[model samples]
Target: MTGTPRLDDPHAFIRAHTALMAPPMVPEVELHLAVETVAIWEQTEEALGEMGLPPPFWAFAWAGGQALARYCLDNPAIVSGLRVLDFAAGGAVSGIAAMKAGAATVEACELDAFAIAAIETNAQANGVALTTRLGDLVGTDDGWDVVLAGDVFYEAEPARLIGGWLETLNARGATVLIGDPGRSFLPQDRLERLAEYTVPVTRDLEDREVRQAKVWKYR
Candidate 1:
């Protein structure tokens, strides 16, 4: 489903290695999370060999996504009966939350094969239906009623592209929302704050046990 090289028995590998759990902030949505970060990283490297593997981002519920899911669940009216897009969807937590909150349709996009598998497996585990697309659709105006992106502004160029794209989408009347844990690349000046949360996270992965994440609406 992604441009990343396909792994042999990817779904089985994820099922064998991860544990089904819910993010602390959004207990209503379940995800297959890595029990330990290091092991999954090593396994992906070994499995992919010379080509190596992308970081197993899908194996964790990032602080931003957790907070966004909590907000969506708490305010279902934002997504009820609407078509939703989850961009750069890792674990698909936001997409799944939108579905659970009564979205008419949910779609997710990712460029990592492992993440694609995780998204599908996690969606099935939660009994939610989702449509997934590979690669970035940053420039496309797909006419979604709502667009969700979480924990994505951690890079220089990508954050800039997404910030500009969100503005374009917002101008077209789409409700664009972004979730971030104050990553260095986040374009704070371009967004309006919506909500905030103290989210639990894997210490080893995030360098802390909890993070101050925020939800922002693209204005």
Candidate 2:
């Protein structure tokens, strides 16, 4: 806890044993996920540069999360002192970024206990405070000023449910935002594009050369 990097420091801590870079989060935001599971990454096709896949899954950060974090950092007015809820907070990158950018508090929800542990550890490494909740998104009822989701609409069932939740949140006057790099179920028509970025993705994960992720404001 003494010298850990945070999400706002602009430094990267890719390894678990090293000091974290950036005040919002550690540099190692990517996680290895099992294909059969609901985790973030599908699988790795090529070996990453100095990045290791520990065990059965790859713990990695998606481009959309990175883009959202960068966006929040660049535009502090969007999140300063607001109550933020990071739905499906994989790797806790976006939540940390919100806190670093001056959000009053952040709550991260995920169904996987492993992800919850990862979020807690990463938050500690980055010297950020966050509340981790373990549960499915369908039952989340707490009202928040903002809800942030990243690359979650890859599957059919999950996408449908998540989209409905976003709509509900929007109806409740909670600003809903998603960071999507063109997943199959991305509802581009239902949301307005706030920003887009050409994110470097591995061919091992997908066939595309790069993922063009967009930050969308839910309508």
Candidate 3:
């Protein structure tokens, strides 16, 4: 009787696996987050019946995402009445903040189906609406006025590709913003710092109780 849960019902999985809670840096918004990192990661792989699938990043509010969401909420003019894209939007924290800050529209894109489900459920939990796109939107541009990416510079190849794309977007008149907590792959030289925050995080995930995360604008 204990086989894998149906992968098609991601919303059910999300609801069953996570708790609806607010991130410490941005308490105005709530997300479905896993309490214990290892348990959720193991459960996700078990349920998917796959060994090499990506970790359940959607189940935690990383420091970078918390910092970015805090920035958006504190400075509403950055997203007010503009079209915003939350790229690699794990649980759509920044996107939800944009909507709360008066963005005209918010589109959250993620490569993981579970992330998409988490985003949708999180949006609903906060009483906001967000358009969800499930796919790899790395090289595409949909004419967003502002693009927000949080916690995306952890890997080398993706960081290289997305850094180039974000630069291109900035050159083409899009306001591109990035949030990161001093990750190894961040293109620091190409960005200008805007704001910083001390975000609380679980030690199991970040190895520290607090992280110094920053918001940067592509230059």
TM-scores, one per candidate: 0.93, 0.75, 0.95
For 76-181, candidate 3 gives per-residue lDDT tens digits of: 9999999999999999999999999999999999988788989999999999999999998888999999999999899999899999999999999999989999
What is the clash tally of candidate 1? 0
Candidate 1 lDDT by residue in tens digits, 1-219 = 244344577787688778999889988988999887888777766765555557788888998888788889999999999999999899999999999999999999998777888999999999999998878798998899999989888989988898889889999899988889999998887678999999988888889999999999965
Which has the greatest TM-score? 3
At residue 87, candidate 3 shows an lDDT of 94
Q: Give lDDT per model, in order.
A: 0.87, 0.68, 0.89
Provide the clashing-pair count of each candidate structure.
0, 27, 0
lDDT of 2 at 114: 49
User: Which stretches of model 1 miss by more than 4 angstroms?
Assistant: 1-6, 49-52
